[model samples]
Target chain A: MLSVESLSCRYGGVVALRQISLTIAAGEFVALIGANGAGKTTLLRAISGLTPPYEGRVIFNGQPIERASCAQIVRAGIAHCPEERKIWPHITVQEHLRLGAFGRKDTKEVARDIDRVYAIFPKVLERRKQVCGTLSGGEQQMVAIGRALMSRPKLLMLDEPNLGLAPLVVEQVIDVIRAIHRDGTSILMVEQSAALALPHADRAFVLENGSIAKQGRARDLLQDPDVKRAYLGEEKQGRLIQDPLAKDPLATTR
Target chain B: MLDLLPQFVFNGLLIGMSYALVAIGMTMIFGIMNIANFAHGEFYMLGGCITYFIAAKLNAPYLVAVPVSVAVVTGLGFLLERVVFRQLRLKSAMSSVLATIGLGLILQNGALIFFGPQPQAIPTSFSAFPLQLGPIFTTEARLFAVAVTAATLVLMYVFLNHTLYGTAMRATFQQTEAAALVAIPIDRMRGITFALGAGLAALGGALLGAIFFVQPAMGATESLKAFIVVILGGLGSIPGSIVGGIFLGVAESLGTVVSSAYKDAIGFVLVIIIMLYRPDGLFKKS
Candidate 1:
């Protein structure tokens, strides 16, 4: 339902996404795996119209959207759950969900959809009135995803959904993602962790230095010797490693 | 001296409400647009000038003129936001600051040319007779100003807390990028916010124009007081601006007991003390 052809994006003199192309069919779960600064975020930003592309086209359901504003792109049925969760510190979780549907005119369906989101994340329902800043990282991540679902998009683009999340929490989030995919919404997820994403994706594209290095079925890429050596082997070594500074202690205080 | 204290406090409350009205608008513009909006005072000046023209020149009633003036200033605000502020949105904050300051100068001078330097008073139906309330006394116009300001404040609180647009505005204030991601028409929101802020300032000017004289140069002092209130209350905090405005007004009113010449200086001194100790102001947004 979405196609990006030979898209290129630049930041000042530096090229962030260079001649990249990808596609996702209806109900497909695609994973874009890349290292830090590999232009994964930039590609998503370009698609969502946050960053204007220097060249190429982004066609959503056969309509060219590279020139559309971020708001227009969202109205065209593409929801981008941006990096770092981007939760407003003082806004409540329920308000975040309502904000996700800001452009929709169906007040009745919007209210129903908010309840639907809560059903998907019961923890979010419990803290609907509480501000997001007070929530745990895992709860915040759930609220972010729930907020994205509030848009009722045809294509949901998730950028680093598992970033800074604990292993157990990551598993729960991935499971929820799988359930959502099973319910028939297309997802294009960007992840630095190949092993975490590949197992759940139908297809995968390995990105390197702003270009696509590999693209195929997820299972084939999982067994590819080079892919195994670079992504999976690294995962095995640091399976227990957790960045202590990922969660700020003072975040809740603010 | 003690008997006169209540009267001083009552006078302070009257002026403080006006300050609060202006400061709230300033704070809202700063919070959402990320612009200090040096031209904010111009909106207030235009509010009073427009009211004067409609009421005094056109022979319209004061009540009819106030809303008309607010609507006119609000329309002007939206036009300026579209033509001037939209272009400066992508530019640096310093550029916006300079642009607004220049805009303020042009507006001030424009008003000077149009209205001239003569001060004008809005003809109100309120009686000039002072009403004694136990140990305190105040004129009808002053009472009307306070009543209108308090009602405006309550209305503002309800609009902001209970409305969808207000929630979206608050969300935009906290996270612009996230707000856009959710398809909130952020540009439109900014324009509306700028207009709303302008309308608010105009309301203050209209109400106060009845109590005090409306001159082309009145905005400068009003703008200065707004800045002091914003800083004293904490930059983007609405409640802070309200409390800070009253504090400044009361302090300045009480300062007249010692020396009326130094009344304006009192707000500056309080602001200096606030900056030294609580740089974030009294109510930092949580």
Candidate 2:
């Protein structure tokens, strides 16, 4: 239930996003794959109202959110777990989850949602009292996802969820993303790792130079010769889908 | 002669608590909103002026005057946040510095024109009585300021740690963008912070007016003391502000006994020495 129409954004002299249009129905897991400087993160930032768009509009649940404040956009049911896992250093793990539900008024429902988040990431539950700054990279990613879940958003936008993590940790995070999608939250995940994301995403869009290069069923995109050659490296040619434990798609052509 | 050491220490601590009261709000503003708030001292002056107007001019009771002063300054602070500080937030860092300095000058001069240049005392109810705790001697006014400061600080600590809004405030301070994702109204949180800081500063001014004197220029000295306290504690650190205030107070008191002429210099000396060893302030690691 999210519609982004002809959205364009610029950072001073550079055009970060140009007339990009996309949509996500309720309960769909969508992935946006791209190389560095492909404007994947910028698209997410524009939709979340963190960056003002120079053209076009964003509609969520049939209401225009192009001019809304970042907080208002969140209240309207889109939670963005941004890049670098920007968790407050001094806050405890439990407090991070609590903040995720800051928009809600019902304490009982909020508490239940927190339990739901913890169920998805038990490591976060174990580190309830520990400050987030002390958490490991994977655990921090868990906290970021858990924090997004606390918002109970209709759509969750994740930027580089698998970045800078150990292989084992990446697998676990991918599993958590799958579990979250299975539980009925629409996800728009941006990743350089097409190998990890395409397998989990129901549909995918390949972004290049601030525009969509390809969009289709994830299964078809994985088998496409161009996508495979460009995104899924040659060394792991046949092993892309065969090995569920394959290493993440390397940052191709960075 | 040694028995008097406790007396000096106690006095230092009492004044230190007053400094803490003013510094608490300043630190919170800096922590969450990243505003140095040069006009913070003007809010203190406004509080004292309001109290003087209520208690002395209108002949109201001290109890009635104190809360009214705090409420008035708090409203003013909220207005400032909405009308001025919020806009400054989008501009460069120098905008906040310039806006606050300009606001401080306006408020200070406005007070000077309205209240005149003469120092006015609130004629506190507690000023008539002096309290003695064993060998230590103190006025009831000083005790009231210390007790209220301690109680307010403890309440602030609880609010920051225990409440949902408090947790949100802490989150906003740490990561503004993340806080927004959770639907914490960033602007609203900042306004609330501004109001609270102003209220605390007003309370300090009202209480200090009873012990010291209230003039248009009083905020200058008090805000300077608060700056010293904030720097000594560490910028944007609550615990740091408290410890720094007490340290400055004790140092000044002890230094005064040695040389009253150099008593004021004690805080500056301590700040310099503390910064040399721990540039982040005494309380914060960095």
Candidate 3:
């Protein structure tokens, strides 16, 4: 369980996240949907301690971790699979999995967990010896998710796991995510595609311009007219807006 | 000329091993920390000076002096990394370059003040008598230096390829953010890497110091050769540094047949050619 209370973050002079608040109960699948540069990635970075917040408290379980280092945050059971699948290009898939459990002292359990990851992604096992740069986008995405699981995390934060992925691959990844959630690992996913994220999440928070615009049950938000119009592209003219906030320079810069 | 070929090759191999040792350290620091440590050779110089102080002045055995000197320099490296280079990490690459250059000047002057301007030799138990090996001939001290360099390189290879810490270092070199997310203490890694790099260079200085004279200015040429080797080999490739070092050594050795006065120019020439044709160096990492 994690709670972010009235968090405000800035990148130099630009306010990336402005007094945002959200929470995830144990084993709950929560989605944060926002347009590009809506501070989705920054929120995850702030929570993981990559970017220190200017104000607010990030309480993980019962402990406040606002000033913890990235390594400390990871050791405390939060594994962040960052945007664009930041896997090392030259490192092998197996090595990536090994690196994921770097904080653990149990070598035997680490080895067992690696095999568990292979079982989850058989394709990753087949390409275990190969460098990640040589793998296809789908295989790389699988490796990224499998790598996140290697930490045995209590809370997994995935930032755009489906970015630049194919439709079929996205479906497979989402299916795996659902199964992982079913197994009681809480997930905090940031997705730009509202239609894709809403159905899979138990609850959702719609972020707009660094602030939480809407928060409710995923099923309720699915049928909300404004949510449908703004996010799902259900305009009166039946023409998709692509990105309604595309004109915002702040949106594009992030 | 043909009768002297083996001797030339033997001499080249000896110098080449020393060059490889120094260049490998330089390359590792460049690869992992992204710092072109201009003060790297000062570690080598300090190693020699410390070994001289222990073996000649303190009356310690040469074997004992070498490791002690290396450890001292390595400790100094760790201290400098913590106090100096760590702060520069947040600054620009140019800032680090300037800082290291200034550090080099300070170290060079510090050695000059402490050790004096005159070159000094490390007293060793090994005989200076030339040992005959088929067609090649070398002194005991030179042979010992070569043997030590070979063993150190083998150990370095094992550490980098087989150990968990080495793998973590390589992973950090490849992706800093991804490495941190996995709970690798990157700051600690940087400190250890800097220390290890300095230790390797110090080992080279200790071994070579026994064979040749140690002086404050010795580091300047050694550092320049290391930079040349790193550029010729590929900026951060360890194997590249080794091969480049040997090639430069052999080329210089052979250059003596034409004109011994310009033998040192061969390395600079080869580096220019490498830059013109293969700007990425001989072994570009994938």
Candidate 4:
């Protein structure tokens, strides 16, 4: 479980996240949706301890992780797959996976987990010996997720898993996230595509300008008129969920 | 003429041994830590001084004096890393340059105050008898230096190529952040890198002390030679260092045969011309 309380963070004088607070239970898929520069990435970076916060604290499993080093955070079972896909280009995919489990000492368990990840993403397994630099963008994303899984993390935080992938690749990746959560791993995903995120998330939070604009169960929020006018934008609205009254609700928005 | 070629070849090989020894450490340091340690040649002088004191004054045996000189200078390197290099850890390249130059100044003055700026020699007492290579006669001292230098260099090659830590250092050199993320301990690797560089410098200097007069300032000339070797070999390339070193040594020796005073000048001229054409040096790139 994770608890974020009144967290405020800044980049120089520009505020990135301000007094944004939320919580996630173990084994749940909670998506944070926002437009570009809406502080989703900054919030995740702050949680992962790669970025220092200006105010407030983060508690993971009853311990404060505000000042913990990135290594320390990983050791504490939180793996963050940054948006940049920061894989070592010259090192092989297997080597990247090995580095993900750097702090782990049990060789047997580590080997077992690597096998588990390989089974989950067979493309990464096929390209195990190839240098990660040569991997396709979708394959690279798979390698990144598989790498985070190598850490055996309790919470896997991913930023924009569908950023630049083809539509087919994006569908496959979102399916992977669903399957990963169903298998008992907690996932905190941030994406600009609220429609895609809403279908899989048990609960969701809409972020606007560094603060939580709304939070509720995904199904109820999907049918809300304000959620449509502000975020869903009614373009392909029928694809998400069929609310009979939701059609007129889009026009009656205050 | 065929017989005389072998003689010159033997001469070149012995001198190449010394060149390789000095340049190996230089290349390792520059490759990983990215600093030249302008004070490296002075480490060679320190080794020579230790050998001189232990052998000439304490009457220690030659065999004992050689390793002791190396160990003493190695300890000095470890100390310098701990006391000095650590301070400059987060500093820019300029800080490293200024700090090392200051350290070099300190070392130079320390040697002067203690050794009185005198040129001294360790009484090697080794045989001056020359082993004939067809038409040429090479002395025992030069042969020892050449043999030791070759053996050390081969060991260095193995360490850099085959071992886990060696591969890790090379990895760190290529990509620092990636290395750190994998818990390779970048700072610790740098310490080993510096020690390795300093130890080899001492070994090369001690070997040279057998033939040249061991003086407080001997590092000056040897450092110049080592710098030329690094430049010629190409920066940060291990094999390049060796090839460049031998090439420079042979060129200088041949230049000496023509006109001894212009040997260093010729090496410089070639270095300038080569750099203009190919700044990277003559080694396979990373």
What are the lDDT figures for the candidates, one per model?
Answer: 0.88, 0.87, 0.87, 0.78
| lDDT (tens digit, per residue) of candidate 3 on B1-286 | 9999988888888888888888998998898889898989899899899999999999999999999999999999999999998988878889998999999999999999999999998999998888999998888889888888888888888877667778788888777888888899999999998998889888889988998899998888889999999999999888898888888888889888889999889999999999999999988765
> Candidate 4: which docking quality band?
incorrect
- Give the Cα error of residue B142 in candidate 4, in Å: 4.0
- The segments of candidate 1 whose C-alpha lies over 4 angstroms from its true place after superposition are A233-254
- DockQ of every model listed? 0.78, 0.79, 0.71, 0.20
| Local error of candidate 3 at residue A2 (angstroms) | 0.7
- At residue A77, candidate 3 shows an lDDT of 91
Candidate 4, position A66, lDDT = 85
Model 3, which residues run further than 4 Å from truth?
A: A233-254
Measured against the true chain A, the candidates' chain A TM-scores are 0.92, 0.92, 0.92, 0.90
TM-score of candidate 3 relative to the true fold: 0.93
Question: What's the count of clashing pairs in each model shown?
Answer: 0, 1, 0, 0
Report the C-alpha lDDT of model 1 over A153-232, residue by residue, as the tens digit: 88899998987776667778889999889999999999876777898999999988999999999989988887876666
Docking category for candidate 3? Answer: medium
lDDT of 4 by residue, A1-254 (tens): 89999999998799999998999899988998877788999998898876879999899999999887666777788888878666656567776676667767887898888888888898889999987779998898988888777778889899988766656677788889888888888999997766667878988898889999989998887887767655675754322332354333222111
Better of 2 and 4 by TM-score: 2
- The alpha-carbon lDDT assigned to residue A203 of candidate 1 equals 99
* Candidate 2 per-residue lDDT over residues B239-268, each given as its tens digit: 888888888888898888899899888888
Model 4 lDDT at residue B42: 85
lDDT (Cα, tens digit) per residue for candidate 1, span B91-174: 888888899899999989999999999999889888888899899887887877788889989988877766878888888888
